[model samples]
Target: MTEEELRQRVAVAKKFMSALPFCHALDMRIDEAGISEAVMSMPYDPQIVGDPETGVVHGGAVSALMDTCCGFAVNLHPECVSPTATIDLRMDYMRSAKPGERIFAKAHVYKATSTVAFVRAIAYEDDPENPVATATGAFVFSKSRKAGKGKAADKSGAAA
Candidate 1:
């Protein structure tokens, strides 16, 4: 895709997450996006501590980054603004994220069809190859339609 098209995709992803409560609270930021790839970043926060004993980043936080990137990647599809649902999110932990560190997530669309969208991504600190975790997800496009150019996804495509 052209740079202009990628910019528009990134803008759409940002707009889509602007209203997400957790996105705001976590301070998640969209680094960039192309036709099938998206990059997102989130810093370690005290609020997202995984364990009281170790005070390391929680696995859920890593999952959240993956989910955000995957969802954003799906927006690249030319299906209009259809509501999408995360039917499944599977994550594999390869390491741990130290506190005060930042996690960078990169997601790519493996395949997308009318009923199901598939995505895979990896999360790591500073380096992209040294994965802290990896995730795969399947999303069901909003079955119903919704109003507005950017809005919450509907359960069905029938417009809410």
Candidate 2:
């Protein structure tokens, strides 16, 4: 992709992440975005600890991060011109994230058809090789609604 296109995709991904209420509350940010992949991160917060004794981050938060990263990848895939909704997602937790560590999620859209997209994601603290969790998911392209002038159109064909 051209530099301008990459910048545009990155902006779109960041805007999407910022708009989500849950993502906003978690203070998620997009570190990088390309035509088929994205990287996002969320800072560790004591309020989101699942195990007070170990200070482990909550599983729910990690899942959300993975899901959002995967979704962003699908949205930014070059072949995808419409919005998509997650049809199914399966996540595997390899281990708990260390306390006081920022969590990073990287996702890639491996395949995309006219109707569906396949994505894989991994969550890590400091190293990508040792992932805390991994996920694979499918998203369906929403053909029912179209986009006009780079803006999403509602069911009634109005800008959303």
Candidate 3:
């Protein structure tokens, strides 16, 4: 992608992320974004602790992070000209995240068709090789999002 295109995609991703209320509540931040990949981070917060005794972050928070990261990856894909939503997401927990450590999720779009995008993601506190969880997901593009424009297009290519 050209530098201008990359900048545009990044700006779009950041704007989308900022608009999500849940993202703001979770304190999620964009670390990096590329053509078909995205890295996001969330700080460990006591409010989201699953185990009070251990102070481990909740699985739901991690799941949200992975899902959002996957969607972000799809939005950055060259073939994905429209907004996207998660169709399916499967997460496998490997271990608990360390207390007080910021969690990170890195997601990549492995495949993109006309309707759907396939993504893989890993969540970790420090070492990605030793992930806290791994996720594989599919995202579907919005039918209302028109090609090369912001308005919805009909099957006959007219604006809806």
Candidate 4:
């Protein structure tokens, strides 16, 4: 991707993050974004702790992060012409996240058809190899929107 295209994708990712109330509540931020991939981070917070004694963040919070990251990956895919919604997501928890550590989710679009995109993501605290959870998901995009000359079109059918 060209520098301009990368900038555009990052802009769109930031806009998407800003518009989500849950993202704001979780303090999620984009770390990097590219053609068909994205990385997002969420700081550990007491409010989202699933176990008070252990201070582990809730599974639901991690789910949201993975889902949102997957959506971003789909939205930035070259063939995707519009915004996407999660059709299905399957997550496998390997272990509880370490307390007081920020969590990061990295997602990539592995395949895209006319209607659906397949994604794989991993959520980890410090090392990508040792993931706290792994997820696979399918996202659906609009058939009505058409891809623009050099960029994926938005839901309004305009180049993003």
Q: Identify the leading candidate in terms of TM-score.
A: 3
By TM-score rank, best first, the candidates go 3, 4, 2, 1
Query: What TM-score fits each model?
Result: 0.81, 0.85, 0.88, 0.86
- What candidate 4 gets wrong by more than 4 Å, as runs, is 142-160
The models' CA-based lDDT, in order, is 0.80, 0.85, 0.89, 0.88
Tell me the tens digit of each residue's lDDT in model 3 across 55-126: 999999999999999999988887676788899999999999999999999999998765779899999987
Which sections of candidate 2 miss by over 4 Å? 142-160
Regions of candidate 3 where Cα sits further than 4 Å from its true position: 142-160
Determine the C-alpha RMSD for candidate 1 after optimal superposition of all C-alphas. Answer: 6.3
In model 3, residue pairs whose N, Cα or C atoms come closer than 3 Å (at least 3 residues apart or on different chains), thus clashing, are: none
The 10-residue segment of model 1 with minimum total lDDT is 142-151
Report the CA-based lDDT of candidate 1 relative to the real structure: 0.80
The sequence of per-residue lDDT tens digits that candidate 4 reaches over residues 100-160 is: 9999999999888767899999999989999999999999964334444333344336633
Model 1: residues with Cα > 4 Å off, grouped in runs: 78-81, 142-160
Per-residue CA lDDT of model 2 for 25-111, tens digit only, reads 998998878888999999999999999999999999999998888989887876566767889989999999999999999999998
lDDT of 1 at 155: 35
Q: Is candidate 1 or candidate 3 better by TM-score?
A: 3
